[model samples]
Target: MTLLDQPTGPSASVWPPDAHGPRRDPAPLLPDPEPFRMLGTPAADKLDPELLRDLYRRLVLGRRYNQQATTLTKQGRLAVYPASTGQEACQVAAAAVLRETDWLFPSYRDTLAVVSRGVRPVAALTLLRGNAHHGWDPKAHRTAPLCTPLATQAPHAVGLAHAARLRGDDVVALTMVGDGGTSEGDFHEALNFAGVLNAPVVFLVQNNGYAISVPLSKQSAAPTLAHKAVGYGISGRLVDGNDAAAVHSVLTEAVEHARSGRGPVLVEAVTYRLEAHTNADDATRYRTSDEVVAWRQRDPLAVLERHLREHDLIDDAGVAAAAEAAEELAAEMRAEFHSEPELDPMSLFEHVYAEPTPQLREQADLLAAELAAEADPR
Candidate 1:
């Protein structure tokens, strides 16, 4: 069977299938490997109008967010930013698939996902701006701090999912990571525990060709990243990450599979990073401009916008409206970041423990006294 003919979810009896089905001759691994595509296809005609419009709006907004965040880093407002320029679909789909009670464990690069899930745009950039406190609280947002350590959030998501299941709560935890993170020991251990405990968790591996300067070819010898799931005895699914409709469809199925108490799921979203790893890294040093230009042809926003227009799901006015909304958000973020934040000197001692020790109390007193003396020095 052809790659497009392969089943898109765990419902297929084959359980796990090679992205290329079964090829008799040795086949060169295609980076995309005929990923399950929906937009620009017949399947797109079946999508709900509401869903299409929502995806369209988010796609436009996500791209704008990435662009603006990268600009902030250039202006020195943000210490650094890992833009999701070409990977908006994965971010939007992952956020759209979860329930409100669910939790999201995002790697540092997933600011788009966090913002798409109702997080305030400026608050989402706090960590990247090198702020002392994450602008948003974890419990209030149901999101974890943007994790900088590679693959560490994997085990945290599993522990939360397993504990929620044991507490009789219908909660699912979804975590995201880049292609390089798969090589980390934490990733394997988390998947192992998630499979054994049947935790209600979903892993979205955005295989965007490279893990910083390192390419996937150097990270693993596996045929496909999705294939990693079989070793842990879980279901695996693949989709064209740039195709927002396909991404939304696949992620929804995976999340439901976990939520229904079936088992954990691993979804590999084959995509590309249109920009460098971060503002600090130079992508041209490693990759050619021509390669980036080719990926630009499949930009997620354009794909979804075209589908929405063809299906009569969104009109020109709707498109303009989405762009206007995104622009407004970008402006607001710029205005907010231009102002200096009031940092309390005492916050360093807070949240470290439920109660402060005598040593800590003594230090707090000394710090307060110093502040008081400065204020009265005239």
Candidate 2:
């Protein structure tokens, strides 16, 4: 069977209330109308103005950086770029709630999330420049390397959470994946193990409706990805991924839940990929113009900007300053890239072993001698 053909159990029938007799009206394709799940008794009042503004800034920076990276790729400075243009809310909100002691496992598109956790901008550039396996030290920040293989990080996150529990630490591991990753065997295995072990972890699924060119409907038969947690007996929720405040609220709750030893939570943030899957893919061939237009109307940055303006937290001047600052930061980043050191050939062999083995040492010496001879030209 194909990926989409995976069994999702029985399907529920759709019928309007007050429908009498067998009326043959076609069911409209209605968007799910779940109420935005806010946290606390007085949800809106629970979050302070400062926290809200900070979230907005982080998300805005993420967007600006993504745009700059795309431009860099076009100019042939970066080898390849994966734009997370529309997924800022998911990255920022989730990263914001994570404690410094907690661990973060991110995918390649989650540079913003890593940055939020105190990883320097220059460190992130190391990976894009192909000079480092990962940008930051895992032990220092408790963050794993950005995994490019789909859903592979899920199991690693589970292992981390397990280790934390064994050590009697209160640390929780949070990892994110695209909607398409849920179909991977690693995703299910990780969830199952977390459930059985009662591990403190959060599985964040950014359901942007497509895995590359494939639509969500063609990827899975499930009505909603959140329901995947039902079999594992873990708490699950689906939130408006485009709503920054909503995303923050849900993640805060998830973090608290895991910290309190309530086991794990599966959060499905329903979002959309505004740009092509990457710089390489042509989304126009698979998705319709009308669909893309509709999603753009709900762009996360635009939605949050309107919210901030209406609430009197930010004004035109604040928006202008933020934009200007973002551009300046991007400019500094590009300059830094130009001055980055050349990759050391021997450095590759240096990190492979704690103490170099006899065979490896001999190979490194041989390579170094060849390099030295070439440079000397004697």
Number of clashing pairs per prediction, in order: 0, 0
Worst 10 residues of 2 by lDDT: 23-32
Candidate 2 lDDT over residue span 191-254, tens digit each? 9998889899999999998998888888888778887886676777788888888888888888
Model 2 bad stretches (over 4 Å): 1-47, 350-378
- Each candidate structure's TM-score, on Cα atoms with residue i matched to residue i, is 0.85, 0.84
Question: What is the C-alpha local distance difference test score of each model?
Answer: 0.87, 0.81
Report the error of model 2 at residue 297, Å. Answer: 0.7
Ten residues in sequence with the least summed lDDT for candidate 1: 23-32
The TM-score of predicted model 1 comes to 0.85
Per-residue lDDT for 222-305 in model 1, tens only? 989988887887887778999988999988988999999989988899999999999889898888999999999998888778
